[model samples]
Every structure is written in structure tokens, then in C-alpha cells.
Target: MLTPMLASLLPLLLLCRISFCQYSSDQCSWKGSGLTHEGHTRDVEQVYLRCSQGSLEWLYPTGAIIVNLRPNTISPVAARLSVCIKPSTDSSGTNIYLDRNGKLRLLLREQDQAQGKVHCFSIQEGALFIEAIPHMDIRRRITAFQYELVSDRLRVEAESLSAPCQPCSNTDMLLAVCTSDFVARGSIKKVDQEEDHSSVTVELSRLYRQKIQVFVSGGVRVRSWTGHINMPLQCGVRSGEGEFLFTGTVRFGEAWMGCAPRYKDFLRLYHEAQLQGNNPCQVDTD
Candidate 1:
């Protein structure tokens, strides 16, 4: 009892479903490329890596996410170098990335910034390879970072250090590198936070600092806290910790402190509010 026209559109509709499925799983593996485990200098190399999902399921519905070391077999088992997949293709035509423990990791879309679009995709095509940048300092070093299209290619880069010279004992070396890549679009996101005189803080923190996707949905409301005149901000609840995490400084009533109009735009804040609404925004730590 199926009409020819309806049947013809089935495949297209199915593909669309696969393309928009919002998925996440907690799982990771070692995806680095170095032999030395000496955490002395900027030459430090990661034996393992962690990743989240970042693409829509299209033709295959499922794709393989590989996380191998830069020079496979150079580091030790404790270094932990591997990759994992949730096999979304098997279930929904999309292969979701997972951690070693089989947990879900979230991949984020890059926002507009000084570094440009760190994580954004147009056509959703091809495999991506990322590079590594040495850390500026050991204390404030970048443990891991996602990559984006520099000009022509997608890249992921890790920041670590090598062993320092004899003169510097505890100082880190600027040699080792951390890098990870998966199939699909390449990108990154930065952690942005806002604070006020009353100690009101809005922090956007993620498991992986580089992979935060920005999504916008209809009916999302945003506002600012500091009440600036320019790009005011909007306030919202974080999903996990239930904290006040403002997006861009938009306008709250009148001040341009921060604002996020849509739920998806403020997904992180919504997530936090859902889980920790009971906790006062002034005292919560997470």
C-alpha cells in the first residue's frame, strides 16, 4: 500500500535524519605520536588522546574514528594511545566517537575569534589531519587542543613540553607535541567566562577545551549581566553543574554584560541549571 512518490523520498529523508542526529558517548583512546614520556621540557609528547563526535551521518550513516599515536609503539601502555568508536552507523547510520572507558565525548563548533573559525564546517566532507603547537609555559600549558581549517586543510594540535636544560630543573621543555584527528570536519573552541563586582562568575568549561559546538534553536532567550552598552551578554544555566554561564555579552535588561537567546546557543548553561538548580549561583564551584 505504498505510493511510488512517497517511497522515492524515503532514502532522502533517511539521510537527513542521519545528518541531524545529535549524539554523544563517553569513550577515548591514545592518539599521539612520540616515544619519550619525559615530562621535563616542552618536548613532552602525549601517549594518548580523547575525542568527541563532530559530523553528521550521510551516505554511510556510520564512520570510523581512529585515534592512533603519532609514532605508534613509541610510548608505554601507561601513556595510553588509542581511539574508540560508538558505531553509530550500526545503530543510526552514524558512528559516534567514544573514550577508552566507552563514555561519550562532545565535539564543539568553533566561534568567531582572533584565531578565526577554529571549528566550523560547510559541506561536511573528507578526513582531517591536525598539527601540534608547543606550550607557552608548563603551568598554564595546553594539555590538548582541537584544530580548524588554517587555509586549505583541517588540523588538530596538542601543546606539551620537552625536558628542560640542565640549568632549569623543574622547568618544562618546549619539544614534545600532542595531536589528534578523526574523520569529518576539523575545528576547536575556547573557554569564555564573565565576572562581576559582586563575584558573579559565568564560566564556559568543557572536558576538552577545543571541541565545543555552537548551535542555535528557535525560542532561545538571552540577557547580559554587566549591562555594557555594546555586545551585551545573556545568562543561562549550565547543564551539569547548574552554574551561570553567559554566552557573548549581549544585554540583560539594559546592560551589555552577556546574552544567549536560544536554548541551543546556551546549551551549556541550560545543562548546568537542569542538574544543579538548587545550588545558588554565588556559591557553586562546578
Candidate 2:
């Protein structure tokens, strides 16, 4: 004998289990479509399905054709385009279209046609999904865009644009030590500025590498290019009464600061080099 509440919950639990098993065994397949713009006609081919264990499937349209030239049959200024989806009994088959607002929509229909080509489109949704390559006017200038589909989700990523070029900082501690002419722990005594350059005087406390004559008590001037010239320093040494690790070259009577490592970071790198039986001063090209 079953209670009324238990009998009511039994049907719902069985329905959930059946749905889960169906999704686990289901495989994705693409439905083909014909795209026509002006007089140019191309067939969009179906691709393989990608599915994970107990996850939603993905149907990819890998053979979607891209036509560059517009036909003379249509107007040169504005060309009309149409996409006709092949009829199928599968409920997963969807008609992909671009609304007037340039948004992608997945509708359950036998066929769909549009006026213009869309930037993105999908052939199916839910358990099975397919996204066409984005074809925007501005995409011509992009170098590359990465596309990925996982568990019925589509992701598109574009490479960063380049303008106003800047130099990248050197992150390798051992490489910074090998390329530098002088490495020491010092305190900034004064900062002097000119029309196009600035100089900072530092009092040395400890010397790690001595390419030139450096005194512990004497002041050392470090020159840096400023103003219009863009020589951005990676580690800035302020004119306060604190000790800092300095790495740079000494030319004439001034030291050109290229890198300034923190005390703890410098010590960690120094010990790591020693434990590996490698010299920090020697450059490792490999």
C-alpha cells in the first residue's frame, strides 16, 4: 500500500531518471542549410558532434562557406541574403536567424530566411548546439579569434589590439642579474631633474656585483631618461630614507638604473642560484 504523497513523488523521480539517461546516451548531429546572397549560393555542411560524459552535446558547423564578392543581380549598395534550413523530424534541429537588432535566435521551424548575413548563428540548442563563425565587417582587421564549444556553450575570444607600443619588463631574476653591470643594496640620497633627464644619488650599503669602483660611504648618481622619451622603469627607487636593491650600468660618473629588486626577492634568487650550483653573474642563453 502506497501513500498519496509517496505515489505523487515516485512519478517525478522516475521522470528525472529517464531524462538523465536519455541525455547521457544522446549524440549530436548537425542539420545542413543553404545560404544565398544575391546570386552567390553556398551549401553549409555538417560537422562531427562533441559530447562529454553525462553532459550536453555540441554540433559544430565546421564547413560553413564564406563568400566575399556580392553578385550583380542584387543592388550594389544593399544585398539581400537568405538561409533555408533542411526539414527534419528531430526536435534538436533549429532554425538560426539574425533578428533586425543583429541578435542570434534559435527557433523551432522548418525554414528561415533573412535579408543580410549575420555575425553569429546557431543551428540547434539545449542537448545539441552549433555556432557558426562570426563574420563581422570589423573582423577583417583582427589577426585571429579563438573559438571553443563545451557542453553546449560557445565562447569566442579575440587577440588584443596593438597601439602606442611599449616595452615589456624582464621578469627572470637570474637574467636580470646576468645582464646588469652593477647590483647592490643602497639608499636614495637625492633626486635631480633636468629638461629631458633625471638623476638620483644613492648611498651604497652592500655590493653584490662590482663592474666599476663603488664606495660604501660615497654617493653614486643614477641617470634616467624622462620627458618625451618613454623609458619606463620597471622598479622605481624613491628618494626616501629606505634601503633598496639596485641593478644597473655605471657610465662615466653616473649609474643608469635598469632594475631594482626588493631585498627579500634578491636574497631568494641568490640562494636559489647557489643551491643549483650556478653563477648568477654568468648569462644563461638557454
Candidate 3:
């Protein structure tokens, strides 16, 4: 009872439906690092092991476990992630010490049915950035701290958008991007000079709303200067056997401020001690 025209249209409609589904799935997979699809209904097996998700296997110095997966359908997707752990918590707290190189590995395998697609996605990938960590070694009552310097500093940024099609008049658009930089440095120290003449310097520069805060006491003193043009600021602390000096220079847009009250008190104490010929160096944990 069916007409030839209707029969022909049925196949075309089915094909269009399949194409739509395929396109939707492909778009979703773009947000993921790895995606595998099985044209059939059989299960698929695969292995994944690495430090962080979305990480390339060859780049990992430490190996991970071989994973055997039974994807519910035919193909399955998986991603390896790489993460860096720091031995020290904060720049002021951690001793920069490096051990023969440290590394870690992890493995993940799917236990359920493996006939479908395996999707390897990472929510944290777009936010990944490099950070500094302090390395330290302690023996008996003595301690030494060292800073591990990272040569490469990378930052990630992302944005989202939504819009509707229109012929005229009505229009709307919204966009935002987040950015951050890794602070890489080779050395950081604080001490007083008496028998050895040493000096320290610290500097920082940012937008008008940004400000740098420094804390000093006893044998420590600080000095600062501002520049006319926008530039990165710098601060440093130097120590010797008899005295210690802290200086900071801020460079930014034409308008800037260089006065920090609490830091001035520290410098005052250091200089006052020098005028009195007294060693202002005192070791105290705060």
C-alpha cells in the first residue's frame, strides 16, 4: 500500500538522522584528548597509564600500568593526565632542594562492558599552568634549602559563548579570557651582614591596582623607587656579616606609589641598629 515516493524518502530521512548523531558526537569529542568509536557493537580493550590525564605516554619518564578495558560498546576513549607535585608548600616556607629528579605514574582501566566509544576527557587541562616548588634536605639539626628553577613558564586561557541566529537589529556577544604567568626564579634568601658583606633586592611591577608588600624587622631595612613608564618592578635583599639591606623598585604606568609603611619600620630598625653599632640580627620564627 506504500507509494514508491514514500519508500524513497524513508531511507533518506534515516540517513539524515544518523548523520546528525555522528556530527553531535564528534563535536563533543573535540573537548576530549582521545576518542575512539567502534562501527560495530563488539567490546574494545585498551590501556592507559600516566601521571596526569591528557598527557602523552612517551613524554612520561615513569611508566604506568597497562590497562585492559572492555568498553560497553565497540570503541572506548581514554586520556592520561600529567601533574607536578612540589616538595615545598610556599616560596617563603619551602627550602629549594632538588633530589636526583622525582617522578610518578598512575594507571586507569575500564571494567564495564567495552563495546562503545572510549572518551578521554580532562576538565583541568585548559587551566593547567607551571608553578615553582622549593626543594630541601635536612640532616641532624642542620638544614639547607635550594630553589628549583623552571626554564619554561606556561599559562592557559579559555572562554565560552552562546548566540542565536537573527536576520537584523537584535545582536548580542560576550567574551572573556583568563590569563596567569608562572613566576620562575633561581634564588631567594634573607639574612644579616656582620663579618660578610651581602645585599638583597626585591622588585615587582603591575597594573595601577596592583601593589607589592614587604615585611622587615631587626637587621633588615628596605628602599624603593618608581619609574615613569610601565615596567616590571624588582625588589631584593642583601646581607653581610654586619648589616642587611632590602631595596624595591616599582615601574609601571606614569602614576605609581612606592611607600609601604610596615616595610619602612623594618628598614628603620636595621638602620637604627647600625647607628648604635649593635648587631640587629636575631633568628626568630614567625
Q: Give the per-residue lDDT of model 2 (tens digit) for 1-286.
A: 3324323433443353345311112233222332321211112322233321111222322212211111123343222222212222231222333222222244322223222111222222212112233332322111111112211111110011111223224344556576655766766777666433345666665666755554333334643211111111332324786666666544322355655656566666666767787654653222
lDDT of 1 by residue, 177-281 (tens): 011110011111222344421112232332111112232222235321111121212323232433322322111111122222232323444355447653222
Point out where model 3 deviates above 4 Å.
1-85, 89-286
In model 2, what lDDT does residue 221 have? 63
**Best lDDT goes to which candidate?**
2
Predict model 2's lDDT versus the native: 0.35
Better of 1 and 3 by lDDT: 1
Q: Per-residue CA lDDT of candidate 3, range 1-286, in tens?
A: 2224323333433353345332212211112111132321111112222211122111111111112111123222222221222111111211111111121111111111121111221322322111111124321111111111111221010000011212211010000001111111112233233221222332322121222322222232433222221112222223223321112222111111122223334345545555676533331212
TM of each candidate vs. truth = 0.19, 0.30, 0.14
Write the candidate numbers in order of decreasing lDDT.
Answer: 2, 1, 3
- The reply for model 2, stretches above 4 Å from the true place, is 1-171, 214-237, 276-286
> In lDDT terms, how accurate is model 1?
0.24
